[model samples]
Target chain A: MPQLERLWNEFKDKGLHIFHVESQGTSEDDLKKFCRAKGMTFPQVMGQGSFSGYEGGSGIPYAFVIGADGKVIWQGREGYHAVITEEMAKVRFPGLGKGSVAKGLEKAAATFAQKNYGKAMADAQKKLEAEKGKSSADAAVVADAEHIIARATAVGERLQKKAENAKAEREYAIAMATYKILEDGFKGQPFGDNAATALDAMKADKEISKEVKALQQLDAMLAQLEKAAADEKKKNLKAFAEKFKGLKAAEKADQMAANL
Target chain B: MRRLGATVLSAAFLFAAPVLMAQADLKGKDAPDFKVGSTINEAQALSLDECRGDVVLIKYWGVN
Candidate 1:
């Protein structure tokens, strides 16, 4: 993480950004403490979904670099500092190896490719704002940034529609996943807010509430049964059998108890 | 001996249950978005969208 911080410092002016995502259910306070303890300064966000399948998702400390063209130029589980530096070097502006406005465009392209539409749009907007009423070269950069914003917004809307469709079909899990994509993938956008609203509505549904409770009960029962079966004491086994006597799993519980 | 064996088998099964839970494959795919408050700036909420247009390095970790 310190390596990443160094990299962020080195390339931030050249249009490099780092977003640290906290996985494994760590609280914000603990994450802050960790950052303070490590003297880290890059921006961080808490992960909303499982990090099981993202780039280098097989494990922790995964990274991916997106080119200004909105494509993933590099990704890996380690050595991101070296990998990103090399990739950024390749995208260096003409006669300007680092810290150039052109390089910002390249970074914006990469962000768009990564599907971080909101950030991509913002970056492009910033460039346009900074270059307003400047030279023709500046105008070109502004035009490019505008193009990125338009493209990113279109893609975001498409994703939002897909999430809405999933909700319409009553595919709660799929809808939730899609909404999550919009909520997280297109933050600060209308789609993101729409996704949040849909999710909140789902949480308020009585049927979903009942289903959640049933699943929780089932899970508790399974844990109890597993514990009772693993116990060597005959008294515990008999007690479990009696406790679950009216339940569907009671027969299996009894059989396991008898084996004890 | 039979009772002991049964207990050992059941214990093994119990331990394996969590491991059997599903793990999604997210590598080489577009990263998902999430929201978290920033430690550097108090009362500020941050999200993945904020890092757009730059090379984003995300580390998923815990304090252990």
Candidate 2:
């Protein structure tokens, strides 16, 4: 963790964002205390099932380096500082790294890469608006700002179209996934609201609604079964088994419940 | 609660918490985006998708 702090200090000026996520089941206060004691000042957020989905072994101190293209460039359990340093050095923000306007542009570029198109566009516009009538050597900065705005706009449109097409085709899962990207990735934007509406409609669909309920019921039954087995409360086991018998994975659930 | 705590602690220390020496399956794939409450500023939330374009290093850690 200290090594990560070192990396963040060294490369933060160069557009490196280090985010520390407290893994599931860990208390936020404990994580905050740890960070404070370590004198770490980078952004820290709670992680929800991020590592649980990792195909690699689930362990503490896992790190992933995501590039401007929104793809994972490097991921590992250790040596993140070295990998991130090398990656950061390779990024060349033309006409950035100096001046307030350039800094704003740099931030805009970073926001654009993160798929926060609306924020990126708004920031770029603000920078450009501030630079109006000021004849400084900010041509390159202006050009990059314009480019970010255009690219963000184009990407936002593409994502919207993709989601719409998926919904039209009745590919409910794909449509929901795409809308989720727009909703969460571009929150506060019009597109995000649109995605939310689409998601609500998708959830209202009868087939999808039924399937989701079944999954929820299965999860509840499994939880109850686990609790009953742990407490050795055999009386409740029969009721759990009866409930499991009606679920999709009835065979496995029934088998486990029967053992209780 | 005790059992859950034990399971969580075991998982946290599982595999020696080693720096992943092996190549990650997610390398080169689109990083999964997430939004969670921020400790730095409780009123604000942090999202992975908002870090786009910068070199974002996400460290998953446990206090235990």
- List TM-score per model, in order: 0.38, 0.42
Q: Could you give candidate 1's per-residue lDDT for residues B1-64 as a string of tens digits?
A: 9999999999988876554443334444555664554434221114444444445455655456
Could you tell me which residue pairs clash in candidate 2?
A: A68-B53, A77-B19, A77-B20, A78-B19, A113-B52, A113-B53, A114-B52
Write down the RMSD of all candidates, one decimal each: 18.4, 15.8
lDDT of 2 by residue, A145-172 (tens): 7766665666567678878876666445
Candidate with best TM-score: 2
- Over B1-64, each residue of candidate 2 has an lDDT whose tens digit, in order, gives 9999999998877755563443357888987775555455221114564355557777776677
Interface RMSD values for the candidates, listed in order?
6.4, 5.8
Which segments of candidate 2 are over 4 A away from where they belong?
Answer: A49-56, A92-260, B1-24, B41-45
lDDT score, candidate 1, position A243: 62
DockQ of each: 0.15, 0.24
Label model 1 with its docking quality class: incorrect
Q: Lowest-scoring 10 consecutive residues by lDDT in candidate 1 chain B?
A: B38-47
Error of 2 at A167 (Å): 47
The worst-scoring run of ten residues by lDDT in candidate 1 chain A lies at A92-101
lDDT of each: 0.59, 0.64
